[model samples]
Target: MSRISSFVEIYFPGVAQRFQKGIALIDERYGVKAMYGLFFNFCLNVSRPGQVDRLHCLPHADYKNLALAVCVVFVYGEFNHKEKCWLVMWEAGIILQIPPGVFVAYPSALFYHFNFDISNLEVCVTDGADFPTPQNSRRLDGGASGRGSCVWFNQASMWQTAEIGVDTIKQAISQGLDATCDNQAFLDSLVFAKIMGDKGQPQPTL
Candidate 1:
């Protein structure tokens, strides 16, 4: 267990179990779990600390050791739903400006969500792509990485907020990604749009 995980478990016993139960509730209420066609692991884990915000899509299948998977992100920011179908996908939508200290548990693989410009953050949660089945028809960018969520950002928003200049843009490009390079060009397009936005010009629709 990570130092953070040990601390949480010792100081906050049953919290992981509570979240698991909550996922069950989400399944009951929105059937997010049913869409995966398999069960998910609620083994709480600590996410790597990040100071910047991100937005991206992902697939939950194969999140952990399971054949298929899902995840719940407890982030203090907006988590928008990319897909529309409830049973086949997470009940898709967006919750703007999510307050701090709030937990948003979700099937990170099943739902493509993004983070707003909330900074100095640490996301603490567990990998949940435990579904045992074939990959879904719509494959998310960084689903295989088990990092859940492409960490892709909304272009207009990222451009408007990050204050990313030529140097920053160059840096993100050098890494071959804007928050989620692993997702490839399909996701990188958002960064390009943001760059265009910085120019005060209309970005071409994807």
Candidate 2:
């Protein structure tokens, strides 16, 4: 079993574009939002290579919850954690354009980091439930290979006990499990462990 070191969690919701466009127009025309409301917790790292000063943004450790809607206007950074490497992970729906008048919460986690470069992009974050800290607290200091593992024992058990579909199981694993172990059996064991751990008994096989 792999131990978790550090990780981050980001939540996105579906909304309409017209509403987002109107909010964007308001932000562009008046600049009042930036001055009065909470700002985006992420920063626009212009020093990175191929990073335009006004085209992207990056989330830092300081990303607390704000009170406005926000989206990833653009993405350009190195996923390999190498020097001068730039990539765009989100293309279409991956970059969510949120509208105003919505409740958005940005919780702080172990892997609290993101990158973007854009202008007039606004978002609000607010505090919610108490943040969860890893049992072994440490910062991630490597490339994609350096990601910490995520273990969802109790929840995984509940889902499997309900005999959820395989696709649902896969999706839950992708979101809750560590990204490193993408194999089928490893994922199956994780789900099984989650269920058995909750029941305080050994995992049973058919």
Candidate 3:
């Protein structure tokens, strides 16, 4: 089997009406696996260490051999990278407008960062773990060292949060399901395909 080292984003349409059901479906589809959702009321600030406060890279690569998938319901912000700016996209097209509710997904491994300028926007994050360990090295310069102690961030630990559940995730998505979210899912899926080591699949040049 190919090594899984990327993230995936899945988008749900009409998320408001089907938020809770979706979570339930995911749970039923992938049982006993640790699933988590993070909701943000305002636009999130995701930047390199010195660039922003709310944004920070993890100490080590997550899931070592798996991918992370994020389902965003609403987006009132944009993702800023070193080379260019990416406006979140929906199923229809580029997400230049922000609706009250939108859903989008994307891989978490690509070399990119995001920031939100709007208030009260919500984000739902669903993740799985393949292996966990303590980090032997710190992310001093925006890069991770391959060797280090490792710790596992498993399902039990994630479910401990009150805000993480099918209902909560669904609520966040129903709040916003726009084009940006759709585009994110597409980009993320591309990354996921690569990590899965699909033969003949084109990988992102980054």
Candidate 4:
């Protein structure tokens, strides 16, 4: 996981920095603990018990996620990556062929994305040691014969708390204001607010 975090920071430096800032603010103000000592929360997805989707997901946008935040998705399985699972971004008309054990980072809140169906594809579990594996592996068996993904991201509410010092929706509700509209307005204000841009202030040394 540390290696994965480093990989993301290397490829998406700006996003990683923004995430760190937001997480730091929240930690100081609200005592929220960072997941795995990082700014992003993690989720693992896998095929249902006996049912096949093999992490093949439906098209959807994470509407309530931080607008400018990037989601780092790590794809893994034993299927043929070349012909099997692929990430599709509907808004950009982009289909990413993500090889197994590789990471792809994108702004999930801004795009409708999903994975290509891999249920119909046969799983080929290899023991040839051709697949990437941990250095401490005891057996020569290859990757798992089912698709799964590890996604790391920040919820918009986390950023909202970091920025406003409180949950805006709850505050709005207490004041008898429309929570939904207030939340949307607050999120719109942050869509391009530049969380890390220099604004006549000293930048923290990372």
* C-alpha local distance difference test of each model: 0.32, 0.28, 0.29, 0.67
Candidate 4 residue spans exceeding 4 A from truth: 48-53, 117-145, 170-206
Better of 1 and 4 by TM-score: 4
Tens digits of per-residue lDDT, candidate 2, 91-162, equal 221333322212223222212334322222332222335443454233333233211111111112222312
Q: For each candidate, what TM-score against the reference?
A: 0.21, 0.19, 0.21, 0.66
Model 1 worst lDDT run, 10 consecutive residues? 144-153
lDDT agreement of model 3 with the native: 0.29
lDDT of candidate 3 over 1-206, digit per residue (tens):
00111111222222221323344444565453223332111133333444442332332323321123333323222322221222333332332322222233432222143322222233222233534333332221212111111111222122222223333445555766321224455344343222223687565421
- List residue ranges in candidate 2 displaced over 4 A: 1-44, 48-59, 65-70, 76-111, 114-206
Q: What is candidate 1's TM-score against the reference?
A: 0.21
What shift in Å separates residue 157 of candidate 2 from its native position after superposition?
A: 39
**Candidates, ranked, lDDT:** 4, 1, 3, 2
The ten-residue window of minimal lDDT in model 3 covers 1-10
The stretch of ten residues in a row with the least summed lDDT in candidate 2 is 1-10
Over the stretch 71-163, how does candidate 4's per-residue lDDT look in tens digits? 778887766675566788998898888887888778899999987634344444345667734542333222224777888877888776566
55-132 per-residue lDDT for model 1 (tens digits): 333333322221111233333322332221111232365544433333333334345444322221232222355543
lDDT of 2 at 97: 30
